[model samples]
Target: MHDHAHGIRQGDNRRLLAVSLAITGVVLVVQVAGAILTGSLALLADAAHMLTDAAALVIALVASAVAARPADDRRTYGYQRAEVLGALVNAVVLIALSVGIVVEAVSRLLAPEPAPVAGGWMLAVAVVGLLANMLAAWLLRHAQKHSMNVRGAYLEVIGDMIGSAAVIVAAIVILLTGWTRVDAIASLLIAVFIVPRAIGLLREVFSVLSESAPAGTAVADIRTHLLRTPGVRDVHDVHVWQLTRGAPVFTAHVVVEQEVLERGSGALLTRMQGCLAEHFDVAHSTFQLEAAGHEEREHH
Candidate 1:
């Protein structure tokens, strides 16, 4: 990996997140105050979603910082998993928030209450929340593609933005049609949007942490590639997994011809590693080379 590209200029994102975090905190406060002042469920729901966005951004900032740490003897793979862990945590929090929203929305639906200040205040707050969510989402967009932590944060903000838009539409409907159930309906819609994103984040993080082979990488293909290499007799015990979001690691036992053993087998292993890295994007690789008959005896 190129030194600059690996650790690159992350400070910009840190600074952006810091600014966005502060703004999000303010938005949460404002939205909550607006909710209480007007007794508006839409405002309250938006406030709760904003709180999630703020927490997600904080986690993303911390995870990105931790992931930038260099590898050490104790942590051979370094701290790249920090982003995955962050995503997992964010997903858990989102699920909890969704549960709370569902409960509140159901209760509100059972006995609908008139939202104070009619529709004007709700619309104003929803508009403000929408703008804030959009700004935060834009700020994190670039970093989101770089790490799972930011991706989780970006999704949260996007969900919040959608929720805000829903609230705005609900307020408009209430203003025109006087249908109060629209607020509860919008809350349910927001819950629907949030749940799948949370589940996806959880699944992706768990897969990476479990050392499951990444999507599109098949063990059979890797084994066949190794077996097809000249002087290689067979390949067995193949293992492939992600070292991080982008770097995949592969390891296998390769049976080689006896003549190749006398002649520098190290070169063969090096060539195999290069091939894996170049074609399969497997950065870290290990290969145990053995003579044909010795392979079965030697626990590959």
Candidate 2:
């Protein structure tokens, strides 16, 4: 496979992760303290989500650093897949925390507790958290489009941002009506928000690990494109998979007419590679040129 040449900023990613992680750590402490003082389940759940954000940022930072290493003889693909693993772990953690938050929120809803809450403290702490998560989310927004590793971190931060908003609203409701169940309701909202995103992230990571073709690609369409090229008789064993997010790799066997093989296969190879790159943006691909029906002999 050739290089797909995706644009990845390892240095910038690390810096963003570091800043986000530190800020999240601070927010976690602040929110946790606020949760205890205010007895706001929304604040508590947001704190828990912030905790996962910190871990995800750490993982993403390490993964980005590892992924930047040059390829070696032993590790031909370099360390790109490390980022995928980090993203996978981040998703799993988010899923776990989301479930726990949902269960706790449901329990609180069932048996409303007359918990004393300092609405002011919850609001103050959550406002700070909202700012931090918003900044972190901004840093990761562009990177998330092209990098699964960064997307994992971004999702965590965005989730916390939503949680912060929930906390703020819960604080307002509690202050106005003295209703404690609103806190549980806010936590449930955060949990509900987290589920679909966490599941989406997991699906992405799973797709990478399972070597599934990138989304929005049609194998049949690709085959048809290849067959339209001159000197190409058929295409078989076509496979496409992502090495990392935004880096798709392809391999295929192209059957050619005997005359084309006798003349030269260089032009056909060039055209095949060009078609894949032009149409599918698949720069990294391997093509095997074979005489028409050559696979029959191999099967025999």
lDDT by residue for model 1 (75-160), tens: 87778888888888899999999888889888888874644445778889889999998898888878776567778888998999
Each model's C-alpha lDDT?
Answer: 0.81, 0.87
lDDT (0-100) at residue 16 of candidate 2? 76
lDDT of 2 by residue, 204-279 (tens): 8889899999999899999999999988888888899987887788998888899998998877788888898899
What TM-score would candidate 1 get against the native? Answer: 0.86
Question: Could you estimate the TM-score for every candidate?
Answer: 0.86, 0.91
Worst 10 residues of 2 by lDDT: 1-10
Q: How many pairs of residues collide in each model?
A: 0, 0
Worst 10 residues of 1 by lDDT: 1-10
Best by TM-score: 2
